[model samples]
Target: MDEMQLRSKIILTDRFDETFEQLKERFSEALFYHISADDFLVEHAKEVVDRAYLTSDREKVIVLSAKRFTPIAQNKLLKILEEPPSKTHFILMTSTKAGLLTTIRSRLPVVDMTSSKEEIQLTINLETLDLAQLFSFLQANRRIDAKEAALLTEALAKEAMRSGKYRLDEALLETFAESIRLLDMGSPPHFVLTRLCLKLLERKI
Candidate 1:
């Protein structure tokens, strides 16, 4: 990677720890500030913004790794991301890109580091999604916890897009992002899954 490539960017990867370690090694010479969390909340976003604003003559890289980023947190950091401080770079590492808001996605270029060969096998096909199938799928995964729910939501979004059978627009994409936010906020996994599937069904082509 060249000096220009080391600038602020979003990195999509399931293996957060490994990807982060590689980045640390790559930016070995620069000052580094890592703020990692299972769920990045508003406070973490504030910390990132604070660290970014600190004057730095040398290259400073702020690595933010999280399984999920709340909408509020992402929004709060939008301004700083759009116009970063001098010699400051940001590397956002996350498990999936579905949860990221369009505003944040637009500000930073995404570098896909995910190497998972396993395809997402969805129980209810988004292309042929119906009420009965949706109910059946929900019932089957009724015991799913929050973390699993987040992963499932990501898979569903991915499968829906890959199927190319839905009228995917910004509104539909935001629903998927909101589903993740709901799950992170302790909402029932089944409920989130139900709402997401229903939204997809509504937009099916």
Candidate 2:
């Protein structure tokens, strides 16, 4: 592995397989061990740690891709990430950074691989969000599934920040994070979105 490919890092992308393939191409010569899941749990983390400890003279890359990573799983992997085995590198790929714990994020550099084209186009203007607009937006997206809802939630949060129209204190920021979690846990998309928008409306500057 070269200088750029030596360290463990997080790759943020909605297209996990595509990004994983790109990483494989980048490190063609290295031995690749991929562990992909919709949700990375503690068992998966144990498998990764086990793979990391395996004796290997050549470069070994463990690619762990998931839609969401549980806090317990992330906590389990922290020690090895901080001090990985010789010639072992980890690449964590996820749809949204909100699902990751700060401790896990602090351990590795995050590279956003998502293109502008992949970002959700927000229909509702968060800056000028009124009750009528909010209700209309909700009605328009009443049938949104969890996956789309997650993307929309992220887009809305970004738009709110970019517009500079909200008093985004830590609590407000945490609401966004919690919204993502609720979506992942199979909460009704419309309900989660409605709650988030109301909170944002209340915090408008």
Candidate 3:
């Protein structure tokens, strides 16, 4: 492919424009489709992928918001992902992977949005959270894949209850799991932390 042709394949979708500009520096050509979720747009968005794929030769890719994925849209994209055109690349980057259709998730090449990562809050008190507990914390407070995070968090919470150091309320355990799932979906850290702390404190011996 010629240099201009190569540049048109990359479709970057993110609130951060500067990041895309910097990312495009590595490639000579990329087709930029700037879109947002509107009632009319979502219904019409599938064409964007189709046109972008057909019109350009560099590669076929879709960058979409995790919270915005729909089953129909994903299934449509999954076809392209499953049987990629030769010399085509499909990269999907999302802050949360939980919303993606399982089929689409399985088919596409998932890449991290390195530009979107938030720095770990320096104020996170680590003195009390050992390795084992910290792992449980991440599992509980997942900002992606909250269902799995809830399961992991419950398992660890159960373990703590079983050890006899704390009381176990099954209902509260489930509630805590739900809170963790919400936190994964983009709740503020303070609210999540507060909910978690109250839950843990309730079971205190």
Candidate 4:
């Protein structure tokens, strides 16, 4: 699914898979288990790029999703993302970007993804929910990092702008700026989101 993105400058989120489903038809599937640097001996760790543990660049990239491991393992995969081999592209599919270490998040660009039509329509068609509704979903979906939440929030803000009546972008920007501040202070996302929701609802009226 991602092979197409490799051809040029493209940021890949899970949606990339949809874009390349047909293109990747014949590409062999190569999967790998998460091997923590601490768990694998130094000697074995050095050999990880080899076939037994890791697949060659010609095959599909190593996918590290939130289901199998913690943020730490994704951090471990940073070495590969940092200095990717000629044909290797690593993909991380996690609900929360908050889980990833800052250094790791910095290395990757957030691919702006079009949220599901359900979400788009929900935000557009439904008039009951306000700006805070989107933030709530951002909180649940972006557990990995503040930046992930921020990225998705920002993307959705753009969507909000396109949707007609709400002053969503400004409301969101203000709310998230505070959210990031709390995040920097080591506050949990729920706490930060709570604060953000209050700010949003205050202005939503």
TM-scores for all predictions: 0.73, 0.69, 0.42, 0.37
> Which has the better TM-score: candidate 2, or candidate 3?
2
- Give the better candidate number (3 or 4) by TM-score: 3
Could you give candidate 3's per-residue lDDT for residues 72-171 as a string of tens digits?
5555665666665555554343333433444565454444443443333222223343446645654555453434444444444544544565554434
Regions more than 4 Å wrong, model 4: 1-3, 7-23, 26-60, 67-69, 117-205
Task: Report, for every candidate in turn, its global Cα lDDT versus the true structure.
Answer: 0.83, 0.83, 0.46, 0.44
Candidate 3 residue pairs in clash (backbone atoms < 3 Å): 7-29, 7-30, 8-29, 8-30, 8-31
Instruction: Name the candidate, 1 or 3, with the larger lDDT value.
Output: 1
Model 3, stretches more than 4 Å misplaced?
Answer: 1-15, 38-45, 56-67, 85-88, 114-205
**Candidate 2 least-lDDT 10 residues:** 1-10
Per-residue accuracy of model 4 over 1-205 as CA lDDT, tens digit each: 4433532122334343453442344344533333222122334324434523443545445443331223344445557667766666554443333333445657865543435432222222223446656566545554546545445444444443445444443335445444554665687765665565455455442
Predicted candidate 2 versus true structure: per-residue lDDT over 1-205, tens digit per residue: 2324546888878787887777778778899999999878899999999999999888999999987787778889999999999899998988667656667878898887776655678888877889999899999999999878888988887787679898866567667777887887899999998899899999998
* Residue runs of model 1 more than 4 Å from their true location after superposition: 1-4, 123-133, 136-151, 159-192, 199-205
Residue 87, candidate 3: C-alpha displacement in angstroms: 5.0
The clash number for model 4 is 9
For residue 204, what is the lDDT in candidate 4?
A: 44
How far is 88's C-alpha from truth in model 4 (Å)? 2.1
Better candidate by lDDT, 2 or 3: 2
- Compared with the true structure, the alpha-carbon lDDT of candidate 2 equals 0.83
